[model samples]
Target chain A: MAYLDHAATTPMLPAALDAYATAARAIGNPSSLHAAGRSARRMVEESRERIAAVIGARPSEVIFTGGGTEADNLATKGVFWARRDADPGRRRVVVSAVEHHAVLDAVGWLGRHEGAEVTYLPVDGTGRVDPAGFAELVRAHGDETAVVSVQWANNEVGTVQPIAELAALAAGAGIPFHTDAVQAVGQVPVDFAGSGVAALTLTGHKLGGPVGVGALVLGRDVACTPLLHGGGQERDVRSGTLDTPGVVAFAVAVETTVRAREQYAERVAALRDELVRRVLAAVPDAIHNGDAEHRLPGNAHFSFPGCEGDALLLLLDAKGIYCSTGSACSAGVAQPSHVLLAMGADDARARSSLRFSLGHDSTEADLDALLAALPGAVERARRAGAWKTPR
Target chain B: MSGGVDSAVAAARAKDAGHDVTGVHLALARNPQTYRTGARGCCTLEDSRDARRAADVIGIPFYVWDMADEFHASVVDDFVDEYAAGRTPNPCLRCNEKIKFAAVLDRAVALGFDAVVTGHHARLGADGLLRRSVDLAKDQSYVLAVLTRAQLDRAVFPLGDSTKERVRAEAAERGLAVADKPDSHDICFIADGDTRGFLEGRLGSAPGDIVDGRTGARLGTHNGAYGYTIGQRKGLNLRVPAEDGRPRYVLSITPVTNTVTVGPREDLEVDTVTATRPIWHEASASVRCDVQLRAHGEVVPASVTVAAGELTARLETPARGVAAGQAIVAYRPDPGGDIVLGSATITAGTRESAHA
Candidate 1:
């Protein structure tokens, strides 16, 4: 059976797997002072240097984390808490509407339980946040703003936000800016220095690395309070005995994915473009979501009028074609997506939307299976209820 | 199909009859995820999952229909409006009438299923007559009185011939998860068995007067009238004791005037009731049948007269506290027990509060 749910989780690349296997066979804790430990510590630093070179960051800036979620949480809450503590008046957090739940939820928790006011900067239909709108919000709140977080590219609809423009605005105000670049790393050009964001989040798994290992790039000037306090690892921000094997594998995966970035993007984008074209031609009313030009090469999202996304997902699953309704985190809840709602979509359109993401193993055959299964599935789903007339 | 035990068994029995039977569970939850049964609900996610598991055990396919928006718009909203209008509405009757037999059945028929099935403890004869199930303790036809002929045409009940014990035994024999699942007894939506709390949360507490029926004197401050239904005895939080220090029952709820009337237990009995949304299984025949006002109420001998799509039932013995919103199911004696004819909503009640 074809596994099309790569956005949910991708198979590890051969290089990453080799790195993990090699590290897993090796002995010693990087923190220990013994010879074995010194060897492990050297391997970790070397892997860190390789990843730093690819992302255009210094080795000291990369703080290793558990995964994308932990990295996003640290970037959001850690930055907000640190800024708020330094200036008691900094009680506001600005976030883009299309942010992942890892950031959206962390910011929401700060607003709800920690007494920090949160303002969501609206996105256009393509899910891109206007830098001017974000600048206006920061200008209104000024120094009272704790932090601003926006994804470099949306994980679902894949609209690549103008991170450089947004960073410049936040930099002028001296408010720390963080961007979740998990989906953007291998799909587009993401240079830490060029982007000008203080902190950036990247996960290994999205780029064909092992799960449970990621890094948060923090500029030398930025100060972030740790969410989890323990043995003061990762420069006193994230504390845990580091997984040496996972780190090596993650770094290996990052370097390999980055090196093959241009070719892979072209191949995946061709497949995604065909998928969008075939889906639209077959299901005429299918509305493609996200930025037509600036979206990630592998992301294709569409809203089919008068059909529930769950129904479509199940039908596709029945034919052994695996995709997703939206973000996998909020799949079970039968509510229209909050991201779609914030993008000015009504409940019906939000409920009707589906996300089909391509990755390392994606092929033309996978798109053919989806194209063949969609028309019948949408028709049957529409027949099951009194469909809402399309807007 | 009625959602009682017998009809559920009947549906399963038919499925076991080697026909292409597809077992279905309707999603009546306004929000199925948060759908709770009052304190002990049966339409819960756990229950729906259990029902799906049962279908899986039977080697059949199951699906959860998104009937939330419709359930809220139809049954739940109707129930709130009924209470707000100073009338008691049988939510079970509304659910069965709309959700199970009509909405569920409608969807089932569209899915190309031969018929919709339930566990209703009522039987349909070869001549298409509605008869009570053999089980005397678990007859649910009282709540299923609103099923129309069109709905009944595609309806099937499996447990109509067996008692509740036999039904459980069959489910146990089949190793269904619901084999030992306790029967639900209260309103499903009220979590934590707090009806008043559910009402208060949904309908904000608008403090009002609890007036004495006798002297027309203002008794004490009470929460909104919607919190109290007819025949309720406790949670009145009354200030003064009755003349004889007897427990008071809620005699009426007036939403317009926003008043709750409380009186002695004697004010609870009623003799006559008028019903709207009447449905009959037999083609307009005069038949001597038993009537039950509530789910657990004893079958009372009654004379039912129909006029202008309304059913007026005059019981042989005056039943006390016949609230306006309860279901009135008609039953006829058969070898099994009483077969259900149809049901209606209690539109009016004759109270013994004439002295007031």
Candidate 2:
């Protein structure tokens, strides 16, 4: 089986699994004020410190949440609401056009339900946000801006953003910047303090940790509202009893993935490059997307001409090669990729795009299996034509 | 799959038959839950979820394919156009013809699936003919008559032999949630059961004269001529009775003149009906067939003549409520039941009064 959808979620590392089993066997919620609770709290704190150290943030700034989505919701809504409350005039939300649905939908909710003026910063042909363009938008909004958000790298296209430049510019503009680093954190060098962003969202499952455990590395001085109000945990930004086992497993995965970042990226990038090169070689018209030099080491995205992505994906799935389409959909009709469209791709190009991401488990054999199935699948999909109703 | 008890049981039966199966719910609406849902709806989020649930129980992969764009173009747009052209369109038949059999089946075959399976209540005979389902009351061969032989070749109806009650019972036995879910009723698109309100929103109001067809006496006015169908006795709101003190019935709607012709009930009866856009299951120049006018309305003996693009059927006895733009499906009455031959959309009709 060739699993190329690592950006969706990777298999948990052995160390994380062991940590989870060990932590789960222990008793007591971290919120309880007893001996067992103290032990649990210690484990949670140690996990937080370990995660913070690896991601370049203070231990106190690590606010654990359910997962990447919750962390993103906390960052977008939490900061936007807090900033709007502090200054009623701050009603504009500026985010990049390529952000994940977590940040995009949350910011959209603010626009629709909370009466905020939402603006999406566009991307270039490579799906990268121009630092200058974003800074200009933030400056123009000025006092009306509640928050600015741009991801470290796009999940679908893997185009890395000029994060430090954009975040520092937003910081200079006196508006908090939030980066959804869910796809960036183990794939690239992520530093909370160095990036100059008020909030960064990272989840475990995307790397190798247990699902349903993630953290929002919020700034100490940043005032953010809590999404869930209960037990007043996680600096009052995120509430609910911490998943002691899940947190332990998540921290181990983060520490391990971060520690091996350079070597892992080198190996996975080589595999990804081979897959991209061979796929293009076999299917000559397949156009590779994203910035080659400035992308996640494990990511390669492409759009095959005259082929619908869903049909191709299903054909590959039949042969046990799992990948993902960059395009979202309503009902069964594939909607063009918002990121690709923002990057100036037409509907046809966006509809034909697919993403294949490598990880710690990806190998040459996996790529071999993919190449074997791809050529025929592309041929069949092309012959099918773009899912138009057969008259 | 519609995510109903019949479909759930169909999926279960297909899985049990050992063919590799994947269940899909065709999403025919642009927006989910926008239409008022009763027992029946074209596409609802709840139905999609229920289908997925049944798939989980049956251990087959499930997906909801968004065919809304195709549905809008083929079914929804045609519906409005037919009404605007003063014809009563059969959206259900159009859906079966274009959506399930064409758009969806084409995609499935391209994606390497041998056939597209559904929970439709119709049987495929061993001799490669489309036959009425064992559960005759639930037989949907009338709507399916629009499907060509190519569609029937790759279509599977797992609940063909089972009654609706038996399908529901099997679903309950299999622990499916939609076992007790009511069978869909009325038109799926018209959620509130208010066809006029739905039509007014789309066609817009066009005031027109409602006149007596025979005597040429102006009866009343109508908001829009398209809002009335042939043989419709309600929604005209005309106060005066006919010449013989008989009730009034809408005999014809002429959108060009924006005039609705109402007369005695006998005027609504038609002996010869001319239908266009013919699709034949098996080609024949002429045949003695059982003709169904409205869906689940009735089947009457008719002699049908088939041409390249048209079908003309002369009913043994004139049938009432025969309207243009509706489907006139031809079927051969088998010893066991009836076999669906093909169908055409009604384009013209010779009323009993004209014949007399």
Best by DockQ: 2
For model 2, the docking class works out as medium
Cα error of candidate 2 at position A135, Å: 3.3
* lDDT values, one for every candidate: 0.79, 0.87
- How close is every model to the real structure, measured as TM-score? 0.81, 0.96
Error of 1 at A374 (Å): 1.3
| Residue lDDT tens for model 1, A1-391 | 5666677778899989998999999998999899999989998899889999999999999999999999999988998889988989999999998898899999999999988999888998888898888878878897899989999998778889999999999999998999999999988999999889999999989999999999999998899999889988798999998899999999999998899999999999999899899989999989998789998988889888887786676667666788887743311335677777877889889889898999988998888788788788888667644522211
The DockQ value obtained for model 2 is 0.51
Task: Give model 1's docking category.
Answer: incorrect
**Model 2 off-target regions past 4 Å?**
A329-333, A389-391, B34-36, B281-284, B351-356
Lowest summed lDDT across 10 adjacent residues in model 2 chain B is found at B34-43
lDDT of 2 at A221: 92
Task: Point out where model 1 deviates above 4 Å.
Answer: A1-3, A14-29, A32-46, A135-142, A327-331, A385-391, B1-69, B100-139, B149-185, B196-273, B303-307, B314-318, B349-356
Worst 10 residues of 1 chain B by lDDT: B1-10
Report the C-alpha lDDT of model 2 over A1-391, residue by residue, as the tens digit: 9999999999999999999999999998998899999999999999999999999999999999999999899888988999999999999998999999999999999989998889998888998888888767876786889888899999999999999999888888898899999999888999999989999999999989999999999999999988899888888777898999999999999999999999999999988889999999999999999999899998999999998887788788878999999666554556788988898988888888899989999999999999999999999998776467435
